[model samples]
Target: MGVTLLTGASTGIGRSLARRLAARGEAMALVARRGELLDSLVIEIEQAGGQALALPCDVTDRDALARALASAEAELGPVTRLVANAGGGEPTFVDGFDSAAFEAVIQLNLIGVANSVAAVLPGMLARGDGHLVATGSLAGRRGLPSAAAYSAAKGGLANLMDSLRIDLRGRGVAVTLLMPGFVRKHEPKPGRGKTGRRRSKPFRVDLEYATARMEKAILARRRQLVFPLSLAVAIGLTRLLPFGLDARLLAGRGRRRPAAAQPPRTRL
Candidate 1:
């Protein structure tokens, strides 16, 4: 296996996936904005007899991202697989529409992937072998209550990956899009949402569960993968409903405004 380069490797899903890939003896280049965290992770992997190079990067910056990719190739090896897993979004509400905030989300979730693809695809095309993996979300399937910005960003990413998958077919570069739902830091607990009502995450899974399935799909080069099955099925059913009805059904769900800013983590 050639070097696998992953962004957002400091925490959450990216960190989990990095650990799993390392355990499987894959030499990797870990990228994240937090250099200290990346260094610590590198040390841990090295102690475990796994090879890893920590390359601090912010995926939103195209030039910086390109430099990081080049460093990965120089230090680890040619990156045969690129996981564009760096993204985060804040809730966007109709009552308080912030274009700057919305653009930030789009930049991270959509343009960030584009930057990563631009940086890596040329080499993959030249070599005729590479895998491009992106972490999307079930929220991308449709517009959510207060996640207008996030939903739009993820939706755009889904289409971008789909288009790339179609265009790159038979070209030796594989594109895999992973759509996961409700990956929480811990077990679900009942809590009051923005509407001041108790809410629960349906069919939520932990980081470990999400990482295992994602790793399998990435390794197998699956075209598109959605999990967990229960949530995917439920979201699939929602797609068939009339837009008006679907909107009504989910209006009360996910209406809570997140903190002022959220760090790059798994899509919620």
Candidate 2:
């Protein structure tokens, strides 16, 4: 199998997913801005008799990302799978809105994925075989009060994947979009909380559980996958509500929680 190039591979979903794929004997091209973490992950994978190459890169930088992809292909063979999972966002409040901050989130979450696809899409099209997967969020489906920027960026990504899937339908390339809600930053230890509950959000799930579902969807080449089912349903229902009602319903949800206050809902 050709190498699977995964961005944001130093932590959270990308990190865990890399290990899961490696266990299946697939070679990996792990990309992230944290060089040390990537190196350590590489060592861990190697120790397990798995193949992995750490390519530290900022997905938002087009030229740098291209170089990283080239290096990955040179070292581990063609990358048959591209998981554009690197992204970040900060709370945007109407009271103190910052255009520059909004742009930064857009660049990282939307343009970054575009850059990644630009680097590998040509090769995938030429080979007529490949998979492109992106980790979006259910937040993208609705505009949360303090997370407008985050919601906008992920919303754009979801639409981008939709268009790509339609465009690549007749070709051999496949596209999959993952929309997850309230995924925990770490795995919950047994007896850590009441019934080992790590988060209070409804249907909140841990990293390992979330990544397992993502892995299955990618392997199955599903067009779109949303979880947990309860949260997905809630978000989906919001879309059917009147604009005014929907806005009022989520008005008190994300009021004071700055985006920086929590780990990125997506990945790096």
Best by TM-score: 1
Q: Which stretches of candidate 2 lie over 4 Å from their true place?
A: 187-199, 255-268
Q: What TM-score, to 2 decimals, does candidate 2 have?
A: 0.91
- In candidate 2, what are the lDDT values of residues 1-268, reduced to their tens digit? 6689999999888899999989878899999999999999999999999999999999989999999999999999898999998876777778768899899999988999999999999999999999999999888887776888889999999999999999999899999999988778855578753475333456778888999999999889899999888988888887788857888887776646445645323221
Model 1 worst lDDT window (10 residues): 187-196
Model 1, range 41-155, lDDT digits (tens) per residue? Answer: 9999999999999999888999999999989999888889989998878777666688998899999999999999999999999999999999999989887777888989999
What TM-score does model 1 achieve against the real structure?
Answer: 0.91
- Rate residue 180 of model 1 by lDDT: 90
